[model samples]
Target: MSTARILIKHGDVRYRLLKVEAASDGSLICLLDKDPQPLKGGIRVETGKLIAEADLEKPVPYGRFSIHTTGEIHRYSGGQRKDTIHIEPLHQLTKAHAVGYFSIPTPERLDTYDASKHTADVVETLEIPTEVSERLTFLLEIGPKALKVATYGIGLSYELYTLVSRSAAARLPEELAASFVEAAALTVFDSRQIQKDEAELRFYQKIYGQGSFVFRENGGAYVALTSVPMARAPTMRVEFDGSELSIETIPFDAQNKPTHKVRFWIRDKGGRNKQHDLREHIRSVVFDARL
Candidate 1:
């Protein structure tokens, strides 16, 4: 059986999750080793060390989305997909329901590769309101390949770190904070030329309306990144108004050009959208962002 170890560097402690896909029950065994163990067994968390003999089985979810064909209802399945997300240290603290990677519900789930060329893509318009909606869309074209989230603390399962960076960010001036994230996103796009992970794009669809990405700038649109706590798989749908579902989804490299460049940024929730920057919303009384 093929074994895989998912290692996370959070704060000062290192946490590892081992998975053996071919296992009989689709469960992961915790090992004392920092890597996946060659033998099959289970383990748990000991006071200040690794606990053995516990079997971890997270549901191997099969994420899929429907396609509107002439008559036949189409469905697409996938290799691996997650339908949730977490902000900062909260995930490390409450690791039970934490989200790591996911798929954006798409008809292309069965496709073996990512979309290299596409002029028209579905852009689900999540109405900007203190009001909630049945459906929302998150365009993956606008974001960092991966967030460089800094962490701290000490623990085996949970590398407990202070949420200082996020909290410390609560003090920055709104406008400056917004500009910084925007510039960094643009730089990552221009330099890396990366596209959103196809699986993540599908997973976002599942978590769409759960959160919203708002801007302090007038006339700016929301990207609906995160909002609902303990994100779960989305199993509902909403009827669209005419043609708002399908819009041109452009890559990040075209963000500054005249072409259609999708844009997104991290910001506070609905009422707190005024706290435009991380430092402006996150506090540093506990722990702070290093660099």
Candidate 2:
């Protein structure tokens, strides 16, 4: 018993509805207040493929009948097409729906977008900035395993790299490793926006700069320092020599006075210090200490 307006368009021709009724077979018998004249070639349902065409030689007994869930109706003028009327369920047809349907161009075949081709087009068009492209290319050359270890050091879960890498491999551009690392870092750090602590913010900021990290070779691992200046006592300190990487945490009492301290060390594995192994060692130590 509810009344709704469904506006349908076929090229230059348009249909304004007076009311609609539900048929027994789940089709809609739309009653038109005014029908477009000269709808000669009849009404043909145009989905990805043609469904069926109805003859307009005799006026439709009711108004227009639609059995399709989604598509358009083409009203032809003799041998040539005249209008195209987009059709949707009464429950979905709205002013907004009509606008959105007309705004986007519908493809002839309803298929998934080609992401590889899109990426190739973007690269060929030189859409990415030169500096960003270079950095991403460098990250790609370093590989995903190394990037994952670095992300782990930055307090991301280990599985994050795998998830991002798999998705990027399937749908993203050629800079798969760079994309994975960037996505993982953004996901992890976005949550840190609520952090108000100055020192903690500075720590993450220093480690993540311009979507990349600055690391110096120390002991068996590439090391970075928190190095935030404190008014009373140092909030935290990370020190690395040729032998070990030491992280120290100082806790304060209720009076904001230094009470107790905790510290840990990741020892160098001598000549076995490949970048990945060193990074893994740092991640384990930091993760265990809850730093």
lDDT of each: 0.22, 0.26
Among residues 3 or more apart in sequence or in different chains, the pairs in candidate 2 whose N, CA or C atoms overlap within 3 Å are 10-83, 10-84, 11-84
TM-score of each: 0.15, 0.15
Question: Candidate 2, residues 146-238: lDDT per residue as tens digits?
Answer: 234222111111111110101012223332222111110101111222212332324334335422122433233333332332243333343
Residues 122-166 of candidate 1: C-alpha lDDT, one tens digit per residue: 211111233322121111111121232332211112112111111
**TM value for model 2:** 0.15
Worst ten in a row by lDDT for model 2:
99-108
Candidate 2 local lDDT, residue 260: 17
43 Cα displacement, candidate 2 (Å): 5.4
**C-alpha RMSD by candidate, in order:** 25.2, 26.9
